[model samples]
Target chain A: MSFDTELAEAQSAIGDGFDRLFAATPDLPLHRAMRHAVSGGKRLRGFLVVAGARLHGAEDALNPALAIEAIHAYSLVHDDLPAMDDDDVRRGQPTLHRAFDEATAILAGDALQTLGFELCLAPGCHPDAAVRADLAFSLARASGADGMVLGQALDIAAESAADPLDLDGITRLQAGKTGALIGWAAEAGPRLAGADIAPMRAYAQALGLAFQITDDLLDHEGDAGEMGKAVGKDAGAGKATFVSLLGADGARARASQLVDEACDALAPYGKEAASLIAAARFAISRRS
Target chain B: MSFDTELAEAQSAIGDGFDRLFAATPDLPLHRAMRHAVSGGKRLRGFLVVAGARLHGAEDALNPALAIEAIHAYSLVHDDLPAMDDDDVRRGQPTLHRAFDEATAILAGDALQTLGFELCLAPGCHPDAAVRADLAFSLARASGADGMVLGQALDIAAESAADPLDLDGITRLQAGKTGALIGWAAEAGPRLAGADIAPMRAYAQALGLAFQITDDLLDHEGDAGEMGKAVGKDAGAGKATFVSLLGADGARARASQLVDEACDALAPYGKEAASLIAAARFAISRRS
Candidate 1:
């Protein structure tokens, strides 16, 4: 099957899984808010888990795939809080805090986070308990102060810093913010299979950077109508990004180079890893 | 040793452990806020873990013990948010959000939550991978919507309800809000040792109720200066509580009875569980 077909299939499967998970719970407003926050997404992170696990011959990747998606959704919800990015809209709809109340939104995000860990630790995610523990451990690092949260802290600190972040500073910031989770997703197959993760790890590091640069490129040049949420948000906030530090053309070139590097790191997997390679290519080419 | 001696020792050890953990992290404001939030607790939950694990002959309880403590601290920090309880004081000091900005407080709580899971998943927590996974999995339920978060949501919902909660409603609310984590802590030893959890589970259930009743009694009768925060806040808000529904004397009687049941449930351990027996007794007797 083509990469697009596989990606679309994975997205559908993950979404269905989440729908089932949510349906099992009581229909409290908090549950409703969680459903609202996690409703729709491209499911790229989920795709990474599913596709990567497939490469390693793991049959039950759906739980971990949905787990990563849940974490991604929770992070987005919290990031969009009034005191954070203060985003009014997400995925072309009102943000959770705006749709519900601030307290409900906060609780929804918190519950979603716990749900992520629960899914990862569930027996369905992987047969090996050690693998489950490893996933939880790696996820905590990716999402905690060492990774995504730390990146957010740095980003917030940068907004008021006397000196604008240079290319290196921005690169470090984006690595923690954007790269860590992606890195974990790409390595999921190896983690579940108890296989060597070096190749996938290297691939993910490059792919993550490419993904962030493409985001910068989209913000710099993509039309707002095509991008769903407002474009130029990073620039508007006066925050330094890949585009700001490296220029639009330079950023695009860099993203292309990283994509190549990402694909090359998967040489050991050869033809079996075609979907992952396509994903790296799609990271830079998509408008949204 | 008496429960008092054991509890004091556990508190000191847990505090030192947290201090070391925080000291190793970068000196960011978020890290500082996390440190502040985790400081000066009585470490009752930590004691539960250590004492329970020792009963089951599990040598390495510190990691899981601290993990639960981290989760508790994170919950408290978020609970004190302006959007939630809006309290400015905790443990006789300014709350995390008050000492720092709201965004920092939110991030600190988020990071601390991740840290809790991280600690549980670490090899040091348990030699067996299955044990680590179990800890993480059980924690998600206790701390998430099914447990603590659900309790808080119900409490919030109750505040705005046209009708105040009856005894049953208040009991269910407190079960979720306060009972979950305490239950998790009390059962940690069996979880680590892969022993039968029925007895410990029963003990925890009764002890948790006793603990909450004591809290209500303290608020109703103790001085604010002694409690380290405002007293009579629950009654002031007109929220239904065990004390409100059972009446002051009735509540005290119920607490004592529950404490007796808690100790009775630990008969399986007999003389080996003296400290736990003391812990049950201490639950209703604590002034703060």
Candidate 2:
């Protein structure tokens, strides 16, 4: 099947899984806010998980995919709080704090984060308890101080810095802020199958950087309506981004090169990684 | 050893554990905030984990004990946010948000929550991977909705309710808000040993309720100087609490009965539970 078709299928399955999980929760306003926060996303991370799992022999990828999406959703909800990025809209919908009150938003984000760990640890996510623990541990590193949170903290601190981050600095920050989770999602298959992670890690590292560069490219030129949220936000804030450091044309060229590297890293899987290669190409080409 | 001495050892061990974990992180302002948030607490939850684990012959309880404390600390930092409880003081010191900025406070809480799961999944927490997964899963449920979060959400909603929560309603909320984590801590020993949870569950149920009643008693009548945070806030806000519902005398009587039941539940363990019995009594008798 085409990568687009596979991605859509993955998104549908993951959405259904989330629905099933959240349906049993009490209909309190906080719960409602949580449901709303997870309601919309491209589910690219979920697709990465499911597709990566398929590359291996894993059949039950729903739980890990769900866990990754929950983590992503919680990050977005917290990042959009008034104290953080303060964005009022996300994925074309009102942000959680705007839709619900700030306290509910904060608590919902906290609960959603716990839910991610719970889903990973819950039975059916993995047959071996060792794999489950590994998954949870990996996710914690990707999302915690040494990764995404550190990146965010740096980003916030950078805003008032006397010197703007250069290319290397921006790359490092984006690696943590955006690349870490993507890298984790891409390695899910190997982790679950108890296979060597080197090849998958290589593929993910390249793919993650490529994804962020393309994201910067899109933000530089994409229309706000098409992007679902405000575009050119980084440039407007005078923030250092790939496009700003490399120029739009140079950024595009770099993303293309990284995509090639990503595809090459998957050669160990031979022809079976075709869809993943397509995903790499699509990463740079998509509008959103 | 006396329960006080044992509790002190647990506190010191947990404190050192936290210090070691945070010491390696980059000393960014945000990291400093996180360290501060976990610095001071009675470490009551940690004591429960160690004491409970000791009862079941589980060694190396430090990791899970640290995990529980991290979860507890994160909840406190968020609960004291301006948008939440809006308190400026905690444990006789400035609250996290007051000590650091709001953004740092939010990020610190987020990272601390993630750190809890990481510590639980880390090796040395348990000998078996299955046990680790179980620990993570249980902590999630206790910390997430259907437990603490659910209770918090209900409490927020109750503030604007036309009718105040009755005695039963207040009991249910307190059980979720405060009792969930305590119950989980108390059950850690049985869970680690793969033993029956019924006895520990009963003990925790009684102990948790008794703890809350005493807390209510303290909130209603304790001095602000000793309590650290404001006292009589619940009554000032017209919120329903055990003391408000049962009155101080009745609440004390109920707490005394609960202590008895908690002790009785430990009869299965006989003299091995002496320190736990002392801890139970201390739960109701302590001034702060």
Candidate 3:
């Protein structure tokens, strides 16, 4: 099947899985707000988990796939709060805080993070308790202080710092903020199989960095109608981004280089890893 | 050892554990804020884990002990946010958002939550991967949508609710809010030992409910100067609490009866359970 078909399938599966999970709980505004936060997304992280599972011949990737998506969604919800990025729109709809209220949004986001860990640690994720523990441990590391949260804090600090983040600083920040979870997602299949993650690890690092650069490029120049959220905010805040530091052409060239790095890292698997390679190529080429 | 001495030791151990854990990482406002939030609590939930561990002859309860306290602290940090309870003081110190900023407080609370799950899943927590998974999984459930967060949402809803909650309504809400984690903490040792949780579960239920009633009583009549935070806020909001629904004398009577129930549940352990029984008694008699 084509990568697009695979991606679309994973998206639907993840959405269905989340629907089932939330529907099992009592109906409260907290649950409703949680549903709203995870309702719309590209599900690219979920796709990474799905694609990796297929590549490694690992069955029952559904739980981990849903887990990563929930983590991604929770990060977005918290990041968009008025106290954070203060975003009013997400996926072309009002942000969670705007759609419901700040307290609801905060609790929803909190519950979503726990929900991700819960799903990862679910017995269905892997029959071997060790594998389940590994997944949950890695997830907590990637999403918590040493990874995503650290990156977010650094990014926020940079916004008000006397000096803007230099290229190295932003790269480090983005590695934590975006690259960590992406790396974890891609390597999850090998983790489940108890196989070496070196190749996928290298592949994901390049792919994740490329993904962020492309995101910066889009935010720098993408149309608001197409992007479904605000654009030019980085520049507006005078925050240094790939586009700001490297210029549009420089950023584009770097992204292309990183995409090449990503695909080449997967050469050990040759064409067997076609979907993942396609994902890397697709990351830089998409407009929004 | 006396319950007071045992409680003091657990508090020191948890504080030391937190210090070591946070010290290994880079010092940032987020970590500082997390430390602040967990710093001054009475650590009643943690004491339950310790006392239960002693009763079941299980060592290495430190991780699970710290995990519950972290969860408790994170909830308080979020609850005291401007968008939530909007409290400015905690433990005689400024709340996290007040000491730092709102954004840091949110991220700190978020990271502390992940930190809790991470500790529970740590290899040192148990030799059995299944046990660690169980601990982490149960922690998530007790603290997430199904439990603590649900309670918080209900409490928030009740403030603006059309009518004050009846006794049944408040009981259900308090069960989710305050009762769940306390129950989980008391059951941690049996869970670690792979023993039946029925006895501890019964003790925890009564202890948790009695604990909340005393909290309501304290809020109704205690001095802010002594409590180190706002008192009378429950009545100030006109929200129904155990004290509001059961009157002062009635509430005190109920708390005493529940303490007896808590002690009675531990008859299976005989005098081996004295500290836990003392803890149940402590729940009502103490002020702060």
Q: Candidate 1 — which residues are off by over 4 angstroms?
A: none
Angstrom error of the Cα, residue A11, model 1: value is: 1.0
Docking class of 3: high
lDDT per residue as tens, model 1, B24-54: 8988898989899889978999999999999
Q: Which stretches of candidate 2 lie over 4 Å from their true place?
A: none
Error of 2 at A68 (Å): 0.3
RMSD of each: 1.2, 1.2, 1.0
The candidate 2 chain A region of ten consecutive residues with least summed lDDT is A195-204
DockQ comparison, 1 vs 3, better candidate: 1
DockQ of 3: 0.82
**TM-score between model 1 and native:** 0.98
TM-scores for every predicted model: 0.98, 0.98, 0.99
For residues B1-288, write the lDDT of model 2, one tens digit per residue.
999899899989988998898879998988999889888778888888898899999877898899889888999999999999999988898999999889999999999999999988888788788888898889998999889988899899999899999988888898889999999898888788898888988999999999999999999999988988878889999998998888999999999999999999999999999999999999999998
